[model samples]
Target: MALNEDLQLQALRLLQADPARSQRDLAKALGISVGRTNYCLRALLDRGWIKIQNFRNSRNKRAYLYLLTPQGIDAKARIAARFLQRKEAEYAALQAEIARLRAEVKADAET
Candidate 1:
């Protein structure tokens, strides 16, 4: 996945886990700047994947709740599946490299 897609996936997962998290908190968790977080959020919003609602009774009047739409839920699932597949492929490659190195080391020891 591209960097933006990766960030979006992380953001969506984080929001699903805790929709009440602020953008600053999200940025911290994502290890990104708040401006980038805001950009990702705007993209999600434009895609109709999430909706922002203000919490009227909250102490922070500017606080918002980010809720995922049904489409967003489905999108997250698909993205997760793809991410898992990519990780699995990487794992397989690493395992192959490890096995090759071990065999090479054993052959060298015999000589």
Candidate 2:
């Protein structure tokens, strides 16, 4: 599956917060299937945005750590800025719409 920018940003944030989290946990938090999470992770790895290391001390041999590279950190910042801009614009539009609706309601009440 194609990894969208939103998913990429969220995954990066989650992994950065706790690199030792399992893929299943990540997928659960992300509300996506494990397979899709795996795909997204592979894409991130291929892009050099993230690096994976096995956790030797963990009892679960399959346990791994996902680390964000410098590039990934920079990418996450950019993505977060863009996401904030979009949300701000959407909020402004919604605010305007609410004002318009309130005005209509007031006018109807006055009539």
Candidate 3:
């Protein structure tokens, strides 16, 4: 299955920590591809969860840096909280499922 909202939140966290990161760098960090990273970034930008700023890099006149806007920071905070809650819920559900499966297996063995 595709990565859930939790992973997306994690991506935001990474971006927040290092706004100057390139798509390739982010992909490497996230264990995804550059293309995928670009896709995710576009989605975040569209949702106003992050932003891109063009600032000249000291090392290269043509190179630019990206910075997060205030709104992006707020959105990251909100999304991070929501992602944590959703992850907790998913974990609980998985635990319950495992318990149910174990019980079913035990019942079958007993029978």
Candidate 4:
């Protein structure tokens, strides 16, 4: 529900989907700043949720791949479930508000 949690979940999914994407590319996909992406990634790395590996005999020496650890995979699943629950709750609330506002508008028109 918090911004960071959402970002973390999103980042996990993206990395799981494609770890080869550059940080800039990941930022673009997540719709966050590169700085923010780095911050989130560092947090994940520190937590031991993910690990970065350098390629062997690769052209781009600086290029690295992000991989989720076993714990990270489990965390991703849990976070995804929580995010879905939160979003569903938000959707229900918004639908209720829209209905209430529509009733108010109809009442105003009748008067």
Q: Which predicted model would earn the best lDDT?
A: 2
The 0-to-1 C-alpha lDDT of every candidate, in the order given, reads 0.91, 0.95, 0.76, 0.90
lDDT of model 1, residue 58: 97
> Which candidate comes out best when scored by TM-score?
2
Full-model lDDT, candidate 1: 0.91
User: Model 1: which residue pairs collide?
Assistant: none
Clashes of each: 0, 0, 0, 0
The candidate 3 region of ten consecutive residues with least summed lDDT is 57-66
- Residue 27 lDDT (model 2): 99
lDDT tens digits, residues 1-111, model 4?
Answer: 134778889899999999888899999999988888888888899888899998777899988899999999999999999999999999999999999999999999999
User: Candidate 1: deviation at residue 84, Å?
Assistant: 0.7
Query: Global CA lDDT of candidate 4, please?
Result: 0.90
Cα error, residue 101 of model 1, in Å, equals 0.6
- How high is each candidate's TM-score? 0.94, 0.96, 0.66, 0.88
User: How far off is residue 27 in model 1, in Å?
Assistant: 0.2
TM-score of 2: 0.96
Q: Which residue segments of model 3 deviate by more than 4 Å?
A: 1-8, 30-57
Error of 1 at 43 (Å): 0.6
**Candidate order (lDDT):** 2, 1, 4, 3
* lDDT tens digits by residue: candidate 3, 20-58: 787788899988887888788877777677767765545
